[model samples]
Target: MSSSPSSTPWSTPCGTPPLAGGPGGADALRPLVATVLDALHDGAAARGGPLPPGGPEAVTAHVRDALADVLPDTGTGAEEALHALVTALAYGAADPAHPHCAAHLHTPPLALAVAADLAASALNPSLDSWDQAPAASALEQLVTRALATEIHPTGPAPDALVTTGGTESNHLALLLAREHHGPTLQTVCGANAHHSIRRAAWLLGLPEPVTVPAPDGTIDLTALAAVLTDLRGPLLVTATAGTTDTGSIDPLSEIADLCDTHGSAFHVDAAYGGPLLFSATRRHLLTGLDRAHTVTLDLHKLGWQPVAAGLLAVPDTTMLDALAHTAPYLNPDDDTRAGLPDLLGRSPRTSRRPDILKVAVTFRALGRTGLGHLVDRVCDTAQQLADLVDKNPHLDLYERPTLTTVLFRPTDATDEAVAATRRDLLTHGHAVLGRAHADGHLWFKATLLNPHTTPTDLDTLIALVEGSTTR
Candidate 1:
């Protein structure tokens, strides 16, 4: 027989920690949250910059020393363990909130969204079945439909499925194409497309993608047309809305028109630029987005939510029938027939966290206009950075800011010098900037995503680069 709570093994001197759910959960969590908040503040204070000083070895040693007693015979208790680990992690983090941390597509999450995430964690709703997440499943439906409608406004019934991120969204898009047209689907993408497209095609047993040239950062229309004409099987032309190395949007309407002419299905990997739909001024950049058979969107990149806020949108709900799966226990036919929403087919993974909660909260708290303002802010900041790069005789701007990525380097620095400067910044914890190869040279790629970054911050980044290059 199962022992009573009082007589359980954990109830001895060790003392079982209070659970995070049910009636008493809030009272139990209050002190623990305070501990965590304190720890976070202390850690960030300790870490004085965007990243901890002294690169990999120092950071690793610091973490190792703090966490030496992993799986110890006796616990350190909840508060101690929480404080120690949280503080260590926060201290060692490459904090995106720092204006100097304009490296990758990583975004610093909003306070409101992060707070909503806490509620999600405490509730711990698994989205595998309707019973597991009744309200969450309903909320997911409402939010997904609304977003899908925004993407495919003219469609009769648009729908979307939440995914882990761009990689999974790309995989699902390919999987759907494979399921509909068999394993013979051949993907065609520009060289500028995200690496996930090639990986997804391989995972789905589809032929390797026919990569067209992207010499000018965007795809070459004539080359793409030639490749599509030469190919003779089931074709899926994958286009990039925002490229990785350089944020350049392909000519969407022209590509969509080409797809129509060639009788090929179109898919846009808008993972980085999808949120441009929120910006009234920038939505025109994704003009033919609705024409795609599938679109990949990653909110984590541009939408300042936490990691893993991704989606795959379709023009019609019927298009998602390919992903329809039936697990007897999770989504029984009787339950579905009796008006219960079938949750199994929504995604490939079961037992998923309600990531939608944070996203929903963010959307409700900040409507289209609010979100649009944030988008515009970052893009404008990028333009300001580009202008700085242009004015700086020591720096060379690769091109004008397309979205929020600005590629530049020391005016005449060699590729090796450019690379060394980036590493020097990382090792010294002076700043965190990314590197990209474009126009036959390695350049510093500042992917500015922080809305609060000021003009002074951009000047500081250029000054840092100038200083690094000299060294």
Candidate 2:
């Protein structure tokens, strides 16, 4: 058209226009990303202290000040902004490596796994399609198979998917159970089962789950049989591998036999105790896991992986078809059965990250035997702490630990005094412990996941609680 479109200023006039900083814009971002990675690595290594107690207002003010100072007025420089944001966030947070960080089901991530996480972030692979993440998709499949092998060595490999966490995995198991067994499907769970199982029933549009009372914090088989008699149609029974408060294990073998007799689908929520599969000493506790129709496990809690690494495993690969759906654009007819199961078809999430890299890297770094040793060490340390409690005249053992958790209370203190002492310990930031109610009394608790924790450290914690009882 007229005179070569009038030569707009935005368009390049001649000869490639300086090549956007001599090799395209990627060169400009390389150094910035490297700087950010260095800062993050160093910050994590320093063993930072806990947060200052100003809460939301202080955090918001810091954010506002940083944005005003670092961000450009006209347009945001994303890389720079991200670096500044991360630097500010790393100022104060709970150090998982700290021996006393024993409150929840959290664990210090393995060093190799952390490195793998960094690699995954840089690659930014999505598991939705092979084109997006070819190697990662294969790695996920391999890790799932490895985990299935641990549970059922003789059975065929089954289908599994990575979920957000234990909550989502439990939800998936409920959904699958409901789909297989219709609208009238009822569930039976022990009184000591994790609360998430009940929540899963509600989310899946099932009636309120039938609760089997566990008088001694272990599933009462007689009560379970009575509940099974009352339920109609297909039944779903959940057996707990490890409970929250007392770390009690349900009688899985007996529950499996009952489900078999009633023709019900048996599911196991082994999210907290699944790692015991690797420990020869404790593996017998989960004796009948292979018989369950489905099982849930959280790698973050006991596998020493980072957060959001949960899995839902089914006995047969075909069971996953219950959740399959075909999206026209997302997974077209062209890519249906090319050895790709389209992880989204089996899981609730679509745009899932390649979480399996950490698992694969961890396995390669520490072989199966090494992982088992680590788990056994943690349990041994827990027993050591329990022994301390037994030997001390001031502390009373609440229950014998079947796993790595120790629940106890002060021998001479009242319930109110125990509560006050726990509060005092939390306020001072000396150590973090847990609390629970059993038999109408509140007890102090600790979940020992850190293998480096010693009996002396627990003794000091007991002393701290005793000292604070009157304060």
Candidate 3:
């Protein structure tokens, strides 16, 4: 009834397929390299807030125009084609380093990490097999052990690996739990848990999640026991170290005890707050991370790394056996018999990049103390903003910031009005702060990652919010 699928992935039976192009992959990317340098210069000169001066419609139109301008034929040469693409990205993309770009969890990348990425990209190490990545295999193990130690110190290096981000970390954790505990397991998480947990459940075909409400963005411990009382099978309980909207951390010690009592697997989504472990003054906040069965951390969020740098650490290495699979052709039993390190089973994706190099470079460049200072600086900014909001009659500070995010709103704005203000600010290139709705109220938020933003920048942002409130 159906036509046979094309034999080759690159082409169909009818339309002509684009060639992989003549030799020289590295040589083709020079234009992109040059364009990045140009972008840096042009971007700095723009002297704009986080984003360019345009709202949603304007952004869409600009992207469409760029796409339309790209030559359909490859005759324009790799240099010209790549130059145009990188130029579009340079001018169109928002700059997280900008003082007013406090809308999301995005962070400005460190220079050293960027250099590491350039090297890693050039090397193109695919760590699926030792043949593909020999040294990289060892490098990943060394870095993984170090990170696992950071998360669960005092114990021998726990199981660990790098992932795309928190979502993949959560997915891998659940996949392991399901393989160990079985398909009969039920997933549980606080209402404030990252959405990835639910997605993981669906992918695993587990039962509907029993979500415990997280008022104030932290789980109500009193209600947690009641929710788990009726569960019938093996369970996975996800705790949040830093919730998305409010940056609230759950009572991890208490949650650990409950999971232990019920024989359920515990996973902590510390994608945003995991960096607190580095802060000597603030390490107390993540004290219970060591007790988690599995803990997730995202280097891209606050670790000053480029995107797609998620990590997972576990106390028991054997738990990862659930994800182990044998491939007679690629990672054959013969290889295992020879005692070669085949690390692909620990993650969902087989052909993975050695992102650990950049992570290793980040820690080396910014040691624990330096990174801790950055964390403290952001926390200080959050407190300063909180106090400013408290003093300002037009602004309402909702909760004391537990981490680096401050949730608040204008004293005189409605839910729609708050959204309207954000749109206006973006359209006019004034400021762009986070907006969210919870507890039957609309709120604005600021996630301060850029320590370079001075008190004057903070005051300017507040003034923008105040001015918007009156309008």
Candidate 4:
């Protein structure tokens, strides 16, 4: 009967590759890293623009051809596989590094951070237990606590959790609130808040949030007050530091006052705008941020780290008590008495990567001043883009940007034409721009996250949009 599965003969795993850890790991990785680097350069050279020519079908076909034989009977060897796939991906990538690729909040990762990520990958530390990630666990604690203190200096004992990104951070915020306030917790947020906030509430089986008007993209204080006054029982008021469609921050102090008046919990989704804390010039934009019970921050958006660098900070370590859990295999009672750090409670996730290493490296490499410079650079570039749009008689600026996002559209163009212009630009691989509806019109949304963007780049973007409208 199938020769008894356990007794079935099996040949040694084919083409066993060298590991990326231990003494010989570096020696083994050196050549493969070189191969990857060369492939990246060659592929990016082939792309020659912000994105590969042709749309989805062309990209899919190219990748399919490059990655032929996804599960080959015999191996093609590690170097060959790495080179082929990496090159193909690089060629097909929507490169955030290209100045014209200013579509979303996606940041071009910092080289140092990426390099640090490589080390983290090599180490392959699983953070669910201290034994698997001894030094890494300590590093995470140090870095997260330091960041928490930055956000809540007045807090009794501020602490933060390393998250995958804003989505996960927002999810954890809602989860923690649910644990504290019970299932009856009602979430109140602005119409302009990130969609994740509502999703988080739904995932937790909580009541559908009550939405307040964001008339000018920031919450209407009077409207929020009215809602808070009417809503009974436990309430959580979620505010937006920077809105997605328009980068407008709610009046934080005013909202906090309402929350206080109603005795409701407060949370701020600053996923897009939290990094302004680094900039001395712009820190005032986030005034009253510390008043929130929980705050979400995403470094991948503006801090220039690779994807998956997000944080959920609380004023005190005790505030996270609701997440405490025990797993005998991971963190046993004896281990705790012996002072081994129990990591399972730090997040809802169990199998977590050492994402903190890259963030720590970035913080060490670039102190407050260096990071502030990057923030200011992008903001300045956005202003320049707005100026170009405002001056172009063919274009109309939605508003003067408060942060790095600039929304503008062709003057007097139909909403349909505005949408088509964005599509035409995407199809032709000319530029990557986003679209947002504001002031009852669809506008071309240029979210400038690349600090390297220049006035010349902004001028070209305006010209391209103007030309597309005519076409």
RMSD of each: 3.4, 6.7, 7.0, 5.4
Clashing pairs in 2: none
**Weakest 10 consecutive residues, lDDT, candidate 1?**
2-11
Error of 2 at 406 (Å): 0.7
Ranking by TM-score: 1, 4, 3, 2
Error of 3 at 105 (Å): 0.8
Residue pairs in collision within model 4:
none
| Winner of 1 and 3 under lDDT | 1
Candidate 1 residue lDDT tens string, 1-471: 434334444434488767889987786677778878999999999998899999999999999988988899987767778789999999999999999999899999999989888998999988999898989999999999999998999988999999999999999999998888888999999989999999999888899999999999999999999998999988999998988889899999999999999999999999999999999899999999999999999999889999879999999999889878899999999999999988878999988989888999999999999999999999999999999988888888999988999999987789999999999999988899999988788999999999999998888888888888787
Lowest lDDT sum, 10 consecutive residues, model 4, at 3-12
**Between candidates 2 and 4, the TM-score winner:** 4
Alpha-carbon lDDT of model 1: 0.90
Where does model 2 exceed 4 Å of error? 1-88, 337-341
Q: In candidate 4, what are the lDDT values of residues 1-471, reduced to their tens digit?
A: 222212222212363556789987786677778878989998899998888988999999999999998898876666678789999999999999999998898899999999999999999999999999999999999999999999999999999999999999999999999899999999999999999999999999999999999878999999999999998999999998888887889999999999999999999999999999999999999999999999999999989999889999999999999999999999999999999999999999999999999989998899999999999999999999988888888889999999899999887899999899888888788889999988888988999999888888888888888888899
TM-score list, all predictions: 0.97, 0.86, 0.90, 0.97
lDDT (0 to 1) per candidate: 0.90, 0.76, 0.80, 0.90
> Model 1: residues >4 Å from true position, as ranges?
1-13
Predicted structure 2: lDDT: 0.76
